[model samples]
Target: MPLRSIQSAIYTTTMNHSLLFTRFTVSLILCFIASAAVAAVAADKPNILIVFTDDQGYADLACYGNEANKTPRLDQLAAEGTRFTSFYSQTVCGPSRSALLTGRQPLRSKGWGMPASEITFAELIRNAGYQTACIGKWDVSNRKAILDRMPNAQGFDYYFGTLGANDGGRVRFHENNEPAGATDDMGSLTTLYTDKAIEYLNEKRDPEKPFVLYLAHTMMHTIIDASDRFRGKSAGGLYGDVVEEFDHETGRLLDVVDDLGLSENTLVIYTSDNGPWNQPKYTDRKKGHPEGSIFWGQSGPLRNGKGSCYEGGYRLPCIVRWPGKVPAGRVSDALFATIDFMPTFAHLAGFDVPRDRRIDGIDQTDLLLGKRDTGREHFYFNNAGVRQGDWKYLKPDAYFHGYAIEADRKKVDELYNLKSDLGEQTNLAAEHPEKVAELKALMRQIEGNDPPGTSPIQIK
Candidate 1:
């Protein structure tokens, strides 16, 4: 038959109409399959477990640079993950924790340190239909107002741990509002919190939706009841014992996740709230950070220890581990502050953090995933130390660093090459007058909302 004649015949009958209908059905089926595949890829969100430590130093973990301390678990985590070299925190507990949870500077929050207006990281994670829980210290407020400023009030489905009122009255462990279990008065509270976290991981985790577990351990913070497993078993003395104990707990969490087949799908971040607090204590107590009069944490060449805005106090270790996604056994010197956690996590979970308020943190997801080289250019630090990038432009002066060391330095201004001199020993203001002025200008721009010279407490 001729081609045109055959075509005409094929289109003429009821059978031809049925054949066309079958063709259309197959095309629709293929389209549906393609869409389903795309959806599956889009829905594979990773579970986030941010392990925030209190008063941990830049050289606290074996993975980062601690020579005397033993952190086997953390070392292994780094071996299997990327370690952040230029990670920074707010330099103190309450304020730094606030920034991580809220994605904004503590100065903007208005309640002194952590304040109240900000939302928790758990809350943001919860909003995305993920299971959210904060299982550790809730030091946003004092003892009385703890529940009001609780992890639940902030965004967690559940809140465990303590409502610490500084180092003296810091609570040990609580499951929800009640005490987790009554341990001996001098018992190590860090282990209790860790145990609670593990319990939550085993029991509360729902497979249908991903979970956000904020394991804010008060490990090195205090009530220095060393874990039974690590007591007197490290090279760095008592401080090493505390760090090692915390590392053991970390190992347990990671092992639990791996054993349950959740390791590949989970993203774990290990960081500290601030630098170690080295309060002068002439004696070792039966419990807590109070036991050690002097802080044993090594600043690793950074000037001034915790409670001040020097590199020792503000800049600390940051380690991230995500199987197959984050680079394994790698180091990135990208500068990232604790405040970037919310934006980074939100971006990973396929959403944007709200731009309703000015956020100091940039989405550091690229830095975390080893995709970006340089971290955020400018970050504000003001938990006893206020600095903007290379210029050591203190909020008004540089005595703040001296204040933490309990010495009264003259109200002399300072400028240093942070890249070349991380210790901040040499004063560059006299030599590089132009650079000092440039950094001061940069500080004004980066500060955005913080007011300068508000506090009147001088070191001298």
Candidate 2:
């Protein structure tokens, strides 16, 4: 053909190519915008930060009536959130951690014997598209470095700190299933754990995904100590010093949350694993401590301390802060426990609690959100006793591991109306046999056909 005909063909082909390129570019930009919107929606889920302390007592903070230990930061936290007056954990550390993680009683979770099969809140929340991290003591693996039962296998994306408690005045650290190092300087843990948590919030976590940071501090457990700046700084002795240091470090963590503009969307929970080791039996354990250190924590009006089936052993100080969600400065006397967390998180994070096994935790989202004041009509204490409404009943042979009371003295079923007798000084079992029988029946019902390898104190 002619030169004019060839030029026309070339122009038409070139124009068609340009149109295709423009359409492809527009499609790419639209895809990018859609991905960004999805990320924003995921980030809208609330962040959960749980600061769990070891062996802290019911009255360790000034907000809880501690006269010697100064805890202005925690006092302010209580003032800024809802303080739970009838909160409870387990009688000891391992059981408490297991209960908190599995939302089951020690009888079902198996405490130190918690198997790899047990599911944790971390697993469920992480599966629901949240970043999960566990920092500090993890006593659920029976203190062993069991790979299947460790944090990584149990659903945490990042794991730092010890697999167990700082028992023996030392702890060995692990970062994501690998050994990091060991430390005997017990005083360094509070600050160190807080630093790790801050690092996670600032650098490690994914910005586009909501996160769960379970910072379980190991301070105030057995063989407690305080750093140089905190030592001898309080009137309540070394234990008091540790408590004050914890308060300051927690304040620092909260400040970082504020600095990152996460205050409104981050749900902060501060609670203890169990009550302090304040019994007379712990006297020998404090032999090497500084003179007049008063290593044990005060139980306030509670009758006994850790390892007893009494108020002090189970009751704990719990404060929750989620601005504009949980009512500020409200003090609630509703009965709740660490075992309730799994189901509550399921409600908040949009996940399902495990249905194959028995879960002892009642969903407490209503209580936390201030929609309801009543929580847990009945809470069983291991297999030894049970509390219903205001009445708590203990069998004649309820196990007491920490104290040295004679067996003969406990020959009769004891009962107390905790509403009026917080100290448990009055025994109302003889006057209220009907209530005793009712609670005993509830305890037996909770005991249920126990699976093998459970606690030996099954209700008869």
Candidate 3:
């Protein structure tokens, strides 16, 4: 044990310690860089805000060819984005919401019978690191506020609205899973829902994380009313009043997005659940309202209205705006539907669609971004019939929700060239048996052994 040997051992130990410290410092720097990179990628993900309205007609807004209703905000939205001419939802409310959420046809999603087992787009997008909130009418829980099928259970981080429609001229509210009381002031819904949504965007959501805000308004449906300020102010009557108020409220929400500087990176989709209740058979029932008879929405030139298997029953007005990303002032006639949102969100949000269940939605990211002109080549009308290209074939005895005329109840297949007859006025099933057979076969192939009529659900 010489002094020289002990000193050398001490020096070697110190050198080894210094080398380990240097390596640890370098590893810390690399880890910090990796974490920063991950955060940057997450921040770059775009926000998705879907504003869904109930029972809005295809030509409800000025941009959609309405001459009476003044929807300046929504018209500006259409001017700033692509207005889809051939967009669709479902023939009714519950089924349409079900299709949008699950991306499956109502027959498979079971519409009002949608089980807790069904996976929703919110579930998928939330899993992909997006903060999700639903701040309005959520009718998919069979309008009963079934806990497991409600928004909170369906993967929304925050839920603040009715679990059902305001069908009885009243709606009960829920915040997350807890009851938040009820309100019968149907007129206040549009602004109230918009306020909640703006609050979520400003206060509830994590600014660092991308988000999905689904604001489903409960206006323009049956038992419709408008705020005192808007009541009786439109040439389109009470329905127009409701629509104009909706437009203004929607503008407020969009303004919040702009103020927050999320516009360029946020994809905003405005659409409806179904066509308006324009049929006299349905409107006549609302004749005894205290504030005069509640008028129905106009279906433009389209035939029939909600609950029928005709163009007006399913077609809707859709405006998609993503500044600089989606072309402005573009009017697209390509076919699209609420069912397509699930898969498209999956693609844009970077999540895989559920592999176990059948999803009927096609990824229309290309169509949305102006990369493609055409959309889905074929769309099925539940079990009623199918539409391919310009030809739509309705099977004999096509199901209608108690609004079909005796003349339309004929026991023969009806076919129409939608290109020439957007109203579906011309029946060509006799002359073009080939097109009818082709679409019929397509329906049979897509629907399998499912029954022709929707599974009966009790409507309030």
Residue pairs clashing, model 3: none
The sequence of per-residue lDDT tens digits that candidate 1 reaches over residues 273-351 is 8887664432233234445423357677787667776687788888889988899999887767887787788787766
- Positional deviation of residue 434's Cα in model 3 after best superposition, in angstroms: 1.3
lDDT of 2 by residue, 1-460 (tens): 8999999999999999999999999999999998898677665568999999988989999999999999999999998899999998998888999999998889888888789999999999998889999999998888999999999999999999998877677789999999999999988999999999999999998887889999999988877889999998988888999999999999999999999998999899999998888866566556545566677887899977788788888899999999999999999999889988988888888898886777788788889989998888888898569988799998988877745243335567989999999988889999999999988888997888655333223111
lDDT of each: 0.70, 0.87, 0.86
Q: Rank order by lDDT, top first?
A: 2, 3, 1
Query: Highest lDDT: which candidate?
Result: 2
Would you estimate the TM-scores of all the predictions? 0.82, 0.93, 0.90
* Cα-lDDT of candidate 2: 0.87
The ten-residue window of minimal lDDT in model 1 covers 451-460
Question: Model 1: what TM-score?
Answer: 0.82
- Winner by lDDT between candidate 3 and candidate 2: 2
Which pairs, if any, clash in model 1?
Answer: 222-289, 223-288, 224-287, 224-288, 281-293, 309-385
Pairs in clash, predicted candidate 2: none
